[model samples]
Target chain A: MDRGTRITFLAMVALLVAAPYVLYPVFLMKVLCFALFACAFNLLVGYVGLLSFGHAAFFGSAGYVTAYTVKMWGLPPELGILLGAVTGAALGLVIGWLAIRRQGIYFAMITLALSQIVFFYAVQAPWTGGEDGIQSVPRGHLFGVVDLQRPLGMYYTVLALFLAGFLLVYRIIHSPFGQVLKAIRENEPRTVSLGYETDRYKLLAFVLSAMLAGVAGGTKSLVFQLASLTDVQWQMSGEVVLMTLVGGLGTIFGPVVGAAVIVTMQNYLAEFGSWVTIIQGFIFVVCVLTFRRGIVGEIMGRFGPKGAAPTGGGH
Target chain B: MFELLGIPPQALFGQLLIGLINGAFYAMLSLGLAVIFGLLNIINFTHGAQYMMGAFVAYLSLTHLGLAYWWALLLAPIAVGLFGILLERTMLHRLYKLDHLYGLLLTFGLALIVEGFFRNQYGSSGLPYSIPAELRGGYNLGFMFLPTYRAWVVVASVIVCFGTWFVIERTKLGAYLRAATENPTLVQAFGVNVPRMVTLTYGFGVALAAFAGVMAAPIYQVSPLMGANLIIVVFAVVVIGGMGSILGAIVTGFGLGVIEGLTKVFYPEASNTVIFVIMAIVLTIKPAGLFGRAT
Candidate 1:
């Protein structure tokens, strides 16, 4: 809402609008999907003070839903994506309900376990095609109007979706409900004493986060025209966490930057095979040990919000 | 000729025994995890990698050091435990003052690095580690056949689990450890070296995982990816048992293993997920876990 921050966000948007012409469309779309995923993840970890380690369950499952609907049922891309988002929210409800029973570290562990359960289901479920995943998923017509097979057509759709998601998150962050959520994050017991049901607020935030991540995953399946077990795996969950952490835990623009940095790194390092895992681990160690503030968070510390902490401000 | 639920006794017992063996490793690994968490106040995420290290060390000892099964039983845990000490003193020691979750994140990174390096050198295919000559072959209990090595795993794990319980629940050293876990500063004021105790607790916990890994090498293929899959299940077990109580971990580990084995008989598809389903129910009914004290 600050003038400087608004201007910065506008400039970033302007750049994104123009980037498809300069860069590869597929790569940019990939970045957009991940940026959105990281943003959804940050909504919980950064704002709600809940570290969920199994977000890929939502993201990956969304991809599967979209892919299955579009490919098997011949649904249009828009419908498929919507179904995916709904699936993510529903899965989120079940998972968030279970996960919110615990706080802090236990919350993370529960989500991870629940996600593992989902992963096992994905592996064994016939519809998911197991390891091969749902492949060659037709891009389908965009609501039976726009042909998404055209790279530019898909790029614009993704851009429009990304901006909508970005603005929705912005609105949520500034809303009164968001303020209540922040209070719960800062002090749940005190928030409850203030006549607020902290658990409901936390659950709502978790669902919203899962829904948006589902959107990203569903969109990603469209872009790539496939959905696979790789999307549902624990490592995918870890990658999203890393993206959010590296960019900035609580900042609005942090996840976007973090996702871009990570996706770019993966693209270039695709040649190195397992070195990717080692390098990611190295970054995690360095980030945890030396710079928990992260790239966006550190900058925000010096120049942006005064009391805003990257994670929940605590001892 | 006897059958129950359309499955022969031999088939059911075979699956149950296999489950018991798997549960043995789970019990040992989770016991180590509970010990470390109780003292260090951080979950050891690198445990899977440490378990993998145990098997790798065993393989290396046989091929390079010219040592055999018995020696690996003695040496691998020591070697891996020392490595755990080095890790604790160097990297993990610094994070004690921060949120314990940071310790989890740090160990996760460590797990990735350890698994990655092994993958680079060994590749993904599991290497063969034959059962020791003395333990080779089987015992016919008339109704069913039991592999001796598998039987040894179950017995050894039970004894080890019991030995750990006796030490912590009965002895003076364990009393000190419990005291330090409750109030390290007060224990330190009482002239105990709480810092040293913390370090050793972590090492011992890690050593327990490595020991289980050594035991697992012959039964399961010695592969880099082996620990990664098993560790997640152990984590689920830890969660179900609640991290606070040692006995909860052991009981849940073995019991879940049996339940999972029986699921394999009735509904093979659900076996991998049955423990998780039970975990979900446990969380709903008793979020503090079977033995964990409610906060």
Candidate 2:
């Protein structure tokens, strides 16, 4: 990462830290969680070159687990989030194993189908509380020290998690394994011929992505103090896709920008009701047709690939 | 008068009839998807929207033009097919050289637009489209009353599916189409206008969806949201059936529909998701789908 990128990221983080004092902390928290969700989804599609249409399985499942643990079993907030992450990892392993068998469109279809099953399970399973979901989840204490009932305190906690997750993703992307993933993305057969077990790497990446997505979902449920049916819907899956696509798939920090824009848009557009879906659809069409590189990608392209290690992959 | 496994035979056969009716729609729709995928190498995500359009068009024809069910059935596909043809000729034709996923994404966007627009105009609630007077009644088949319209839908879809199979598997035109799919450049050298053929193929495939929509209008409410969810299920069906063979799509569509219907009778809660459950199991055992060859 360059000085400019680093400085910009820090500024963004600072803004997020101060936002709760100025703006609504709960709303900001929602955006942060969604941004993290979008970022994790971006890791798979943008970096690993796998487009999964069923990420809600992880996101929603984690939310349910977090809610259940906190509300029913009386787990602390941090542990509830951890439980959610584990749920995501477990699902990712099974789904990744099955999905990696197919390539391209078929892989997408498999993920979608698997997630649909998860959706159905959530609907019927009594633990999910059916349509009612787990409501009024206690935020509890973080690390048994920081009181999370205060909006500002909760906001900082989420911001800390976001920053940690974001930094870890950045480190992963710059690491050696990340390079291999890029290779696999650019050309899988050639990578396989080069003696790398591409599927294993892909599966691992899938699991990590799922776990992070789960963290986001889990965090969001805590912030709202509820885990509901909306999280697992196919529409939620589509929303993540739209965010990543609009922000520029594969670009670092793009999902954050994309998620922020979308969340804000949805927040303001909520009053318009179904028109929100209509407008989002319009954005998808426009982005696919004219701006496939996305907002960050387009700007990054204008500056050239400067101050970065070359891995031979271009947008 | 008879009972099987303590369940009345009439209820059992009635469900079977409903299963067949559903299977007919599935067969027609999946056949369309398979045909489009074969030629264009693109999943037509807008297919469901076009199916919805077909129903809406038929409804419009009946309400506005005072057209009968038979005439609406004949006209709706043509109208929707022409719309699809225009779409292919314009936007979709440009993405032929790029990645196939772009086609899927573009069509998905188009689906959103179509479905959204309909929702805006017509609202989410379905409009009732009654069965034609000619086919309004039922047949007493000893065990159950099978609606004539339902039976007609099944027979018509069977004929359409099989006729498409025959034309594609055993005809001169089909040979050209297949050859083009294999190698468009080589087929072009043989004096075939491959691009035009692709456009027509897309139109034909979309028309098949519209045809199914017309058949479905009376059975289900003619609503804009009707096709949106069904298309995803059909995608699962296509994956499971392996889009590799026309016959595979037909058989799988019908089979899964019957399985779903049976699940509804035995375990009502699972009926909504049994097809997806079956898809997951299929993926675990046969990654390329039941009939799909490894790409």
Candidate 3:
């Protein structure tokens, strides 16, 4: 990573480490899980120019699988989360294969449709326990070493998971493969002319993104000891999109900040009930209409390394 | 009792009729969406919310103004259409030069605002819109019983769909519309009011959805949450139809509605998801859509 990026990231990490001491650790844990979720989403929209509207499928399903395994199969927490990540990868493989056939707006619609199919399955498939969901999921001991029953143990574990996912996304975005993905995003026809299999790159990026989303989802359920329809709902998918947009679509750490802002809003706005939807919708309109660069993206433009693109993929 | 394919004919035909009535709404809404997308190049993500508004207007007019159902049918579309025009002029028109996705995002937010506010006011529970006295009864054709209102819905929707098709495909005004959609600058040079047409096209498209909502008020509860639930399915119908052709949108919307109804008859659990399954298959085979002209 560049000096600018590294410094900013370490500073953010320090803030997160110190955050729980002052704020409720549970709420902070929720923010960290969603930050990881949005970062994975940014990996696709920011770099690859592919918008997958059904990401909640990966995030929610991984949560479900992890919750089911730990609570029902009696597996260790780490293994359950690993299995959740695998499920997300498998779902990505199938969804990406179909969704990549279309591009732009149609691509968004296809992902949304496929995710609805997943939502219906979650609603009907009895193993999910229907509307009640797999509740009271035991966080169990982390890797059979640290007892996660303590809020601090759970909080640090979530922070570690978020950092791992964030760093992995950073690594991928700077890799040669990420370069090819960006090339395709800028000019697909030229990328093809360069003899690159653009579709393969897209599919691989989609899989990686989905796996990370799954990791976040699985860890989230463990944190709350519950997995419900709320996670898999289309609104959750939209929430991720909003988080990504508010943070800055293409910049590193933009989605993390966006997720933090949104999660905190939900916590504060809980008493307003459905007013939250209106407020969120208002944010969507304002952001799309004017502030598409988002908070983090703007910060990067003014202070970070020069030559950063003014707007990231699919403004 | 006579059976068709081991299921009772009465149940099968009843479901099919329900499917056909649903198909009518799908046809009308998708047709409007097709028209808007063809000209504006942006999906009207708020189509559902506007539809719910149509129903809400009907209910509100009834409760507050003591306007009868017939009066609501006449007035709701105009009210909703005017609101749509206001939105088009102020907001949607701004995004014409940006990425089409921005338009989608903006409309989606507007929809959430509309639906959420209505839900807050009405508490998500449906308020009833009674069938007009003239259309309150049913007709039995020996094989199955049909509600008079439902039969009228099919007939009225068919008339509306055909009327719109004739106007767009055959009329002088439609000629101008077609030309404007193809080349607005040239149409403007020829002294045609292209911008007005664009705004009207958006309003008209939204009006079509509202009209369907008016028609649906009697059969379905006028609920805040109804449109959001229904519009996603309409989106699936639009995908299967493709945005390239007007007729394709009409035919596919009705076709899928019937197919969904049939799924209800055969595999009850899959009814909700059957259209989406078909959409996936169509995407794999013909990503542009079954009827849409390829770019």
lDDT leader: 1
lDDT of 1 at B216: 96
TM-score, structure 2 vs. true: 0.96
lDDT of each model, Cα atoms only?
0.90, 0.88, 0.90
Per-candidate clash tally: 0, 0, 0
TM-score per candidate for chain A alone: 0.97, 0.96, 0.98
- 1 versus 2: better lDDT goes to: 1
Rank all candidate structures by their DockQ, best first, as comma-separated numbers. Answer: 1, 3, 2
lDDT of 1 at B271: 91
Per-residue lDDT tens digits of candidate 2, residues B183-256? 98999999999999999999999999998998899989999889987887888898888988999999998998
Pairs that collide in candidate 3 are none
Q: Write the per-residue lDDT of candidate 3 for residues A209-234, one digit (tens) a residue.
A: 99999999999999999989998988
- For candidate 1, the per-residue lDDT at B219 reads 90
Native-to-model Cα distance after best TM-score fit, residue A162 in candidate 2, in Å: 1.3
* iRMSD (Å), candidate 1: 1.3
Better of 1 and 2 by DockQ: 1
lDDT of 3 at A17: 93
lDDT of 1 by residue, B100-153 (tens): 767888888888899989998999999999899999999999989999999999
Q: Rank the candidates by lDDT, best first.
A: 1, 3, 2
Clashing pairs in 1: none
Let me know the DockQ for model 2: 0.53
